[model samples]
Target: MAPTCPSEVQERKILRRSRFGCRNCKLRKLKCDEGKPRCKRCSSFRVLCNFMPNVPDLQPVTDDSSSTFVVQGRAQLQPPLTSAVWTSDASTFYQLDAKCQDFVTRYLGRSLITPDDPNMIKVNRKLLILAFTHPFLMHASLAVALAYDRHLNSSLGCRRTVEECYHRSQSTTLFNRRLGEPIETRDKDTIWGTAAALVILAFSAPDARTPEESWPLKSSDPSDFEWLRMSRGKMSLWSIANPLRQGSLFRAMESTFAEIHSPLPEKGIDGIMRPLATLCHLKDSSTPGNNPYFNAAHAVSQIQDLLDSQVKVGQTELFMRSLHGPFESLLRGKDPVALLLLYLWYRKAGRSIWWIELRARVECPSICSYLRLYHKGYAAVHAFLPGGSLAM
Candidate 1:
């Protein structure tokens, strides 16, 4: 027998760089941006933006978890539909089974926006219209709604279900694809909406079932406490989207964002707890640039003020946003001192923020466990936590 040649041994599959690119870009011989609503080049060139992912009308399926739930009990994502329509405005298209379609239509808006705030009603409707037009936004909304549903309805602290992860993966793919392209003015709110939803998802869903498996007490990885990084990333979108700018529908969230983002005092930690102050090593001489803990310290101080005022609002993103890299790294690296500071903040934040109470259910206890197990000598610092002696 002749020796087989390497070329004959294996046949390579040739790949097309523009596999999902729009026809106009392929015609113009340019790489398509592959974003939704319209690709950047098509939007700039002012032509019909058409491509293929064409979904044949999905024959309406009966109500069943077979299509909507996990393929197995594992957290594996559902495979996407292969074909889609030529003229649809969204990025990816697939049929939601009857149960999912109904859930999204009925409970999704309420899961996201508070009905108590009359202003949020308009925000909810506006987002629904945008979600219809932008598939990435739609998936992001679904992921959030599903997670919020589980949070509200679960009898115990439950792990994220596979269905939630599927929409999250889909939204992440399309959202990142759009972020890479030349951002058109019209796509700003859509982009912002998706970013905001993902931020909520990040905060609300962690993989662990109990505090022992949560951050600090749990093992560390590059992605641990991802909510902190996500909060920072969403803030960067503000310059691009400028939700408060005239004619932007997202301006409806302005009061909510503004409420949590009240400026730090001109010069002190007046509202901050003395125990937290000492834990942070804050001094009259200390300023943000000089002390790594300064910003985290300042943030908790503001939270203290909010709690004292009996403000009913709650978006604890303030803790993540106000942190500088040094302090954030300390938290990510699972430093006891850093975890102690966070414990203090978490205890205070949970008092008023019902949503944060869900996270504190795991993390706050984990911090106490970690301190009790490893840093027993730091009795003074650990005292700030629940069951610890040092009261704030």
Candidate 2:
């Protein structure tokens, strides 16, 4: 201990005084002044100075062999107190489930059965990501996936009906609760997401009719029309979300709607449609302007255009596009002319395996009686039936 070096003494004093650094300084691998409110480095960079909360005080360990002692602290530091804190909420936990994540991923990639419009795909992906934070939307999305899976694979040794029903019931209850929430309290993104989820649910869920129940004029099945009504509601909510409408997500959805509902070119369906329009006109000439036939004609023209566009693009998109605007109400009316137009649309839509499966399993048998009653004497209608004149 004779003639101890002054430099060594100074180094030991400096080391003893050093404490843990601020989060920013640690990230930057620099020395921290550990100033209150803001560190020197953070102040210089004009960034928020953040320190770890509830950190255990460091204790210096003495070394018997050497004069220098190492400070012992946590090897891995916690995130800054200012950083976002994630907690376990119902919504967060639901989205974190591997099954739900996988379903959402598959849905975003392959659910629509279309030509893969990047914009539509991007918007759907964003909706699913946003759903993680929104319990209602998360449930709605899960419900749709479950319903679609049940419909497609129920007979293929899939999950039990009881389990599927339980989950769907839960999801539907959550969705309805959100729907009933006061408009002022809910955010616009949540509303839009709910609407989108409803659309998917409409497509995926089975009709409300029992197997033995025959199709009536209105079908009495809520499933047949629930999605349609929900879609209209979705549009209504979308109208209120003015700021959201400016985003690419809204633009993509709008563009898809426009493409789906765009007026049909005259040439594509004029041949088959000319007879139907004439029949509609002959059936009710009293008020030409207000006639369903005229309305049906205009609607069929648009449907034809939709089919032609799908052909050119080499893909068959969702049938919901055909349900937009007046067409939904018209189909619900059970007017023979409107039904005829729908039949033709279904035929064209039948070209897609998706539409074929839907028609054979869900739609055709449900509407069989109504179609037969209306087409009683007409060979044209017979031809369009499941095994009638049409090859489809």
lDDT, candidates in the order shown: 0.66, 0.48
> What is candidate 2's lDDT per residue for 56-99, written digit by digit as tens?
11211222212211111233323213332211123222313345
Model 1: per-residue Cα lDDT over 27-102, one tens digit each:
4447877988578876665443666433111111234434532121232454545542111243344446654676
Kindly report which residue stretches of model 1 are placed more than 4 angstroms away from their true locations once superposed. Answer: 1-91, 111-115, 259-261, 305-315, 351-355, 389-392
Shift in Å, residue 313, candidate 2 = 13
Candidate 2 C-alpha error for residue 146, in Å: 2.5
Q: TM-score per candidate, in order?
A: 0.73, 0.57
Lowest summed lDDT window (length 10), candidate 2: 56-65
